[model samples]
Target: MTMASIAAPARTAAGELATFCGSLRWAELDEAVRQRTRELLLDLLGVTLGGSRVESSSAPRELAQGAGDGQATLIGTRQTSSADWAALANGTAAHALELDDVTTESSLHPGVAIIPAALGLAEELDASPAAMLEAIVAGYEVTMRVGNALNPASAYARGFHPTGVAGAFGAAMAAGRLLDLDDERLTHALGIAGTLASGSLEYLSNGAWTKRLNAGWAAHAGIVAARLAGAGFTGPSTVFEGRLGALHAYTDEPYVERLVEDLGRPLQVMRVSIKPYACCRYNHGLIDCMLSLRGSFGLDDVERIRLGVLSGGALLVADPIEQKRAPANVVDAQFSAPYASAVALVYGSGSLESYSTEKLADPRVRRLMSVTDCYRDASLDAVYPRQWPAAAEVVLRDGRRLSTRVEYALGEPENPVPLDALMSKFISLAGRDDAEALADRILHVDADPSVRALGTALRSGGGST
Candidate 1:
């Protein structure tokens, strides 16, 4: 058969990896790709540490305690659960704070959802850490390309969180790799993961904790699917392109071609944005611009703040409750543009501490937010969903005006966050001891045979917190 015929069979065959899993060499990846992966892993660790402290994390820790027997670590929660449950617990904790890294195309918290799931299962299997990283890299590529084919707006506009719905499959891909599932087994794992995919954007309207749970759901589902595949279960191979399949039901329709089109050639997670603030990724540029002016203008001198952005940016943070407008719940605060922008100008950036009710409702913070106005700017909206930024104007009581605009946020591939800053951020969130060691270990993750040794030590036998 010619090359084209071989490609055709590869696309249509049952155990073909649409069965053959390519062992992508780390050395083959460009230095930039490796560098980006390290940065993302670092940011993910920080977010997971902080998120592990959230109240949402408490439920899982409680359950793990009740189970009374298991051998898996719950991230920074200092608890233990069965391997699968540990994945669920850590995954939930990692995303509970909503500070996890997000990719533009994956349209999901790729790091929080996929990493914990992949790593959690890998630890249980005592799989080679390098193989685990390769799986993660492959999984990231699949999800983002699949998201591209998904035409996310179809479900997103209808109040469903598309990322969670699709992220399960990505996590499964990673699990399949670590489990060493051959073509048929990998196919079964992917298909089995389909039934486990769930979550809706309705939580945004209710301020529910489901938003955080969605990430954990993906991690859990992937682990379960992998377990079943290992147990000799089978599943349909054409999960995505089937007549009444995941694509037909959830998205406009999956562009099947994108699934393996450029699989090993490029890495999608490398392009992920490491958010500076806990608020929505859409609002970061405006927050960035505001923080820039706050330095020169001073918070006390500012009488009013105005944030202008593209339509998509505005939609993300516009809310119903006046409290949501000014926010009290940390979850709610992350969705409030006016509250976030004002806080950044008055303060600096929104971290776990910034979104507490006390901070959100502080009289001075409210005063600044009350004067804040969010508007749609035609120029910014023109290139949206691709390249869009924010412009902020600060009007001072002293009759002075200062304005700043950004075309891109700081942590994008183009304008990356420096390693020094990433390390400090990690130390702040995870404590210096844990952060420094994990940073060195994971940056070279592709080389290690097993991360279990490291994971066991970090299991935080603080025992039930």
Candidate 2:
């Protein structure tokens, strides 16, 4: 009933953020939040393993060269490095495939960026199993809370990559937990990380794989920030709301109030959605809409496709369909909504093969992709940054047009992916593996204690990328 219970966050020591994060009582946490964190972790591992099978990575392998040999496990590549570099490589690998978790509101995938930081630190610090899980949950809360305070739509519009920008601070908080820093050092790590945070949306314009590496960079920077704080360094206290800081720099209209409010209640990570498809989360709804419409029209019947989505998201997926259509590279295929939708209709499924070179160049797939006409749907666009949706309509050459609307996308928090689906998703991405066993391993992450065995199995187990 006191102010501490109400404004308890305001009284927190700027430095003890890490300890506070580390001290989270797992038993007291809502079952949903705890379970969701495990789901995310499993998903991250799957994605990282999958990314390893992709074309040569300049950054992950590049970072490994500098690491030489220390004692950190690189996901796909045969390399060893310090905990921080290992975290960076693994984070990059995890996010490389665009198969990581996504927050609908923030439009950022926090786990890919935050988990590597925590995992690396956990391995180095020899932290208890329970402590590691608790830290991950705390990291998600911190990052999501920070992102929730800002205008995510505006940030995306201006071309700042939210995952890398906000992800750094979140990774720092999680790493701080592993390091056992008091509020002072923890807060310092955050403040320092805020300045170091950065990533742009330029990759959407040009097919570049660096954005995939941003998660690792953000996560690595976070661990570095924690180490800096541990070394007795100082950082600004008002990092989030500082006059010339993050919120102000990123947007003209900043909502700073959401950052500190309900700092520890409800848990933001629980609100995150795991990606069921490899393409951008913004386009997943349209993919679903198309998938639903597939039943109505066969490839022969389909004449043209009309794709509509929240205006803000249209640019990322449906816009510039020309180059985004028959993408020459892996990253491009992942960004093309039309391509993904076409793959769904042509193949009756949207999986790794949907974007393969053979598939991308397939005459039928290209023809289907060519007909995808995209425009902004006012109905869905009205929601803006609140809750996003995509609309689709497929017209057969026979003049029959089928339309479907998705109020909430499959992967969005509102219509979250079932835990079983997440596990199945992991296997799908981790390469054809025993999905049932993989899911069980993730479900019992704590019971097995050190995930070294599971990690080892997941790294080498999958058959396909």
Q: Best-fitting candidate, measured by TM-score?
A: 2
lDDT digits (tens) for residues 209-233 of candidate 1 = 8887887788778878867876776
Candidate 1 wrong stretches, greater than 4 Å? 1-22, 26-28, 65-70, 77-79, 252-261, 296-304, 320-324, 395-401, 432-434, 445-449, 460-465
TM-score of 2: 0.90
Reference-based lDDT, each prediction: 0.69, 0.75
- Give the root-mean-square deviation of each candidate in angstroms: 4.2, 4.5
Candidate topping lDDT? 2
TM-score of each: 0.88, 0.90
Span of ten consecutive residues with least summed lDDT in model 1: 1-10
